[model samples]
Target: MTQPSQGVRRSYGVKAAPYGFLLPAAALFVLFFALPIGYAVWLSFHRIEVKGLGLGKGSRSEVWAGLENYTSALTDSELAHSALRILGYGAIVVPVMLGLALFFALLLDSERVRARSFARLAIFLPYAVPGVIAALLWGFLYLPDVSPFHYLLDALGLPQPDLMDGGPLYFSMANIAVWGGTGFNMIVIYTALRSLPNEVYEAAKLDGCSQLQIALRIKIPMVAPSLVLTFFFSIIATLQVFNEPTTLRPLTNGIPTTWSPLMKVYNDAFTGGNIYAASATAVVLALATFVLSFALLRLSNRRTTQGATR
Candidate 1:
C-alpha cells in the first residue's frame, strides 16, 4: 500500500506531536487516578474471609460480596441522619454565606463606602487561617461562659441558652463555614465586579436607574459566573464538612463520631477497623457530591443562558 504524499505525511506528523506530548499525562492519569479508582472498586465489592481462629496466613481470603456493602450503607440510618443534618446545615450555610459575600462585594465596589480597604482586608483575613483553628476560635466564642453575648446578657439580666447543644449547634457549625467561606467567595465576586466596564454603569446612570437598581439589575447579573463558581465550591465544601464539627467535638458531647459523612468514614476506617466499608462510604459520598454538583451546574447554566437570551 502506498503511504500518504510527503505534505500529507508531514501534516499528520505535526498533528500527532500534541498526542505524543500528552502521553506522559495519560500514563500518570492511569498510574494515579485510574489505578486507585479501579482498586477501590475492587475493594468495595469484596470482603476478607476469616477462617479457623483467625490467626494464620490462610485465615483471611478475599471474597466477593456483590452489593452487600452498598446496600448496607444505603440502608444505614445513621448515615442517612448524617446526610440530612448536613443538608439542613448546607441549606442555612450556602445561601447566607453567598448573600453576605455578594453584599460585601457590592459594598466594596461602591464608591461612597468608607474604609473599603480596611474592611475588605479584615473580612478576607479569615480565609488565611486554617479551618480547624477557625472552628476552635468560634467554638470557644459560642460557649456561654466564654461568650461576650452571654456577658452582655448577664449584665442585662437575661438567660443564656446552651449554644453547644441542640439546634444551636447546627447554626454554630454553619457559622464557622460561613465565616471561613464568605471572604473567599466575596473576593471571587469582587474580582468579577471589578472587571466590569465603567462605561456600562455610567450609561445606566445616564438613564433612570437608581444605584440600587443599577446594582440589582446590572452588577449581580454580570457577576453570575463568579456566583456560579462560588456556589459550586460551597456545595462541595458543605458536603465534605468534617473539620469544624470534629474540632468542636472536644467542646461538646452532642457531636457523635458519625456527625458528618466524612466523620463516619473516618470512624469506620480507623475506630471501627473497617477500611473497606469506610472506603465504600467515601466513594458513595464522592459520587453523590459529583452528581449533585453536576445537576446544579446544568440547571444554573440553563437559567443563565435563558436570562442572557432575554
Candidate 2:
C-alpha cells in the first residue's frame, strides 16, 4: 500500500481539524446539558409504583404516567398562584432593572459626565456578589428592625410599615433582583454603546442633534439588539425565580414554599416527594421559556428589519 499524496493529506487534515476542535464541546454539551434535559423529559412522563408490601426487589417499579402528571400540574392552583406572583414580580423587575441599566449606560457613555470610571465600577460592583449572598444580605436590610428606611421613618415619626408583608413584599423581592442584576445588564448595554461608530456621533453633532436626541434616536435604537438579549435573559431568570424568595422565607412568613414556579417544582420534587409532577412542571416551564423567548426574538427581528428597510 502506498501513502496518500501530501495534498490529499492536507485537505483531509483541514476538513478534520474543525470537527476535532468541536468534539470536546459537543461531547460535553451532550453529557451535561442535553442528557440532563432528556432525562428530565423522560422522568416527566414516568411515575413510581409500589407493589405488595413495598419491601421486596420487585416491590417498587417505574411506570409510565402518560399525561397524567402534566394534567395535574396544569390544574394545580398553587402552581398557578406561583406563576401569577412571578408574573407580577417580573412586571416590576424586568422594566425597572432594564430601565436603570439603560439609564446608567447612557450616563456612562455621555462625554459630559464626570467620574465615569468610578461610577461604572460602583454600579457594577453588585454583579460580583453571588446571587444567594446578595439575597441574604438584602433579606437582612428588609427587616424593619435593621432597615434604614424603617429607621428613618421611625425617627421622623412616620409610618414604619412592614416591608416583608403584603404589597411591599413584591417590592422587597424585586429590589433584591434589581440590585444584583442591574449592574450586569448595564455592562452589557454599555459595551454595546461603546461598540457604536464615533462617525455616527460626529454626524449627529454636525446636524445640531442634542445629546438627549442622539441617545434617544441613535444610541438606543442601535443598541436594541443588546436590549433584546438582556430582556430575554431577564424574563427567563424572572420565571425561574427561586433564590431570593427561598433565602428570605426563613426570615418572614410572607414567602411560601411555592412562592415561585421554580420553587413549586422544588417543593414537589424534594419536599413533597413527587418527582413526576416536578419534572412535568419543569418541562412546562422550559416550554414556556422557549416560546416566549422565540416570540420576543421574532418581534425584535421584525422591528429591526422594518427599521433597516426604512
Candidate 3:
C-alpha cells in the first residue's frame, strides 16, 4: 500500500480524537445504565416456571411471559393508590419548592441583603444532609411526644393533631422533601440570577421601577430557563421518591410498605421474592419518567422557539 500523506494522517487523528475522549463515558453508560436497563426489560418479559414439587435443578426454569407482568403492574390497586398519593405529593413539592427557591434566590441577589454567605449556607445546609438522615430528623420532630411543636401546643392547651396519620401525613412527608430539596434548587436559581447582566437591573432602576417590579418583570422572566430546569429535576425526584418515605415508615403508621411505587418494587423484589414483577413495575416507572421529562422538554423548547421568533 502507498504511504498516506501527513495531512491525511493528521485529518484521521483529528476525526478520531473526539471519539477517543468520549470512549470512557460511552463505556460507563453502556456498562451501568444501558446494560442494567436491558436486563430489567428482559426480566420483565420472563417468569419462572415450576414443575411438580420444584425440588430438583430442572424443576424450575425461566420462561417467556409476554405482557402478563405489564398487565398486572398496570392494573395493580396498590400501584394505582401509590401513583395518586405521589401525584398529590408532587403537587405540593414542585410548586412550593420552586417558589421558595425563586424567592430565596431573589433575596440573595438583592443589593441590600446582609450576611449573604451565611444566608446561603443556612438555606443550603439541609441539602447537604443525606435524605435518610433528614427524614429521621424530621420524623423525630413529627412525633407528638418528642416534638417541640407538640409540647408547645400542649402548653397552650391547643388540639394536637397527629402528624403521622390521615391528611396531615401528606404535609408531613412533603415537609421533609421541601426542607431538603429547596436549598439545592435555590442554589441553582441563585446561580442563574447571578449570571444575569447587571445592566438590565440598572436600566429598570433608572426608569423608576421599584424592587418588586424589577423582580416580577425582569428577574423572574430572565431566570425562567433555570426555573424550568429545577422544575424538571423536582418532577423526576418526586417520581422516584423512595428514601424519605422508606426511612420514615418505621416511625409512622401512615406510611405503608408500598407508600411509593419504588417501595412497592422493592417490596416485590426482595421482600416478596418476585423479581419479574418488580422488573416490570420498574420498567413502567422508567418509561413514565422518560415520557414526562421529554414532554416537559418539548414544551420548554416550544416556548423558547416562540420567544425567539417574537
10 residues in a row with least lDDT, candidate 1: 1-10
Alpha-carbon error at 84 in model 3, in Å?
0.3
Candidates 1 and 2 compared by lDDT, better number? 2
TM-scores, all candidates, are 0.89, 0.95, 0.94
> Would you give me the overall lDDT of model 3?
0.95
Clashing residue pairs in candidate 2 are none
What shift in Å separates residue 176 of candidate 3 from its native position after superposition?
A: 0.5
Model 3: worst 10 consecutive residues (lDDT sum): 1-10
lDDT of each: 0.91, 0.94, 0.95
Ranking 1 against 2 by TM-score, winner: 2
Tens digits of lDDT, candidate 1, 219-262: 99899999999999999999999999999999999999999999
Q: List the pairs of residues colliding in candidate 3.
A: none
The pairs that clash in candidate 1 are none
C-alpha positional error of residue 144 in candidate 1 after TM-score superposition, expressed in Å: 3.2
lDDT of 1: 0.91
Q: What C-alpha lDDT, on a 0 to 100 scale, does residue 164 get in candidate 2?
A: 88
